[model samples]
Target: LCYFQQGSQSHSVKHYWYTSWPDHKTPDSAQPLLQLMLDVEEDRVESPGRGPVIVHCSAGIGRTGCFIATAIGCQQLKEEGVVDALSIVCQLRVDR
Candidate 1:
């Protein structure tokens, strides 16, 4: 976690690191990563007016896109009772 201040504006930053997952391999189990995502969503919910959440890893969109697609799909499922994974993945490609 970190904090930055500039001329009366302040920002609180938090980071989540999952190091056990290898660079180019799928995780053995999704439990840990799912827990991490829940924690991040909880934090984002707690802070309503903060800036965007940043998700990244050592490389590129492989893990980044997976994490984001899952997060969004889960949210959509909870709120709408359905998960449009294809739509979400397609939007991810378009947005990227």
Candidate 2:
């Protein structure tokens, strides 16, 4: 996956950091690398009038699905004071 910092005025990025995913289950196990990725994303978000983050995998399906689910769950949490994403996904699947 690639991490990028985008400028506000243009769609092109100002800076980027790239890394291969490590065989780690937890973010804590990949502290430095994970932090670097987060920092790049944060920088992009902080750019004035920046557009949405464009995260994509080659297939852009599996990871994209998870990210969309996570974002929806996060918004729901803020709105309804829920505490879990897994539970939300489970409930959504069940409700459907």
lDDT over C-alpha atoms for residue 45 of model 1: 98
| TM-score of every prediction relative to native | 0.92, 0.42
Best by TM-score: 1
Candidate 2, residue 50: the lDDT equals 65
lDDT of 1 by residue, 28-82 (tens): 9888888988999999999898889998977768888888998998899899999
> Candidate 1: what lDDT?
0.89
* Deviating ranges (above 4 Å) for candidate 2: 1-45, 83-96
Q: Which pairs clash in model 1? A: none
Give stretches of model 1 more than 4 Å off. none
> What lDDT does model 2 reach?
0.54
**Candidate 2 residue pairs in clash (backbone atoms < 3 Å):** none
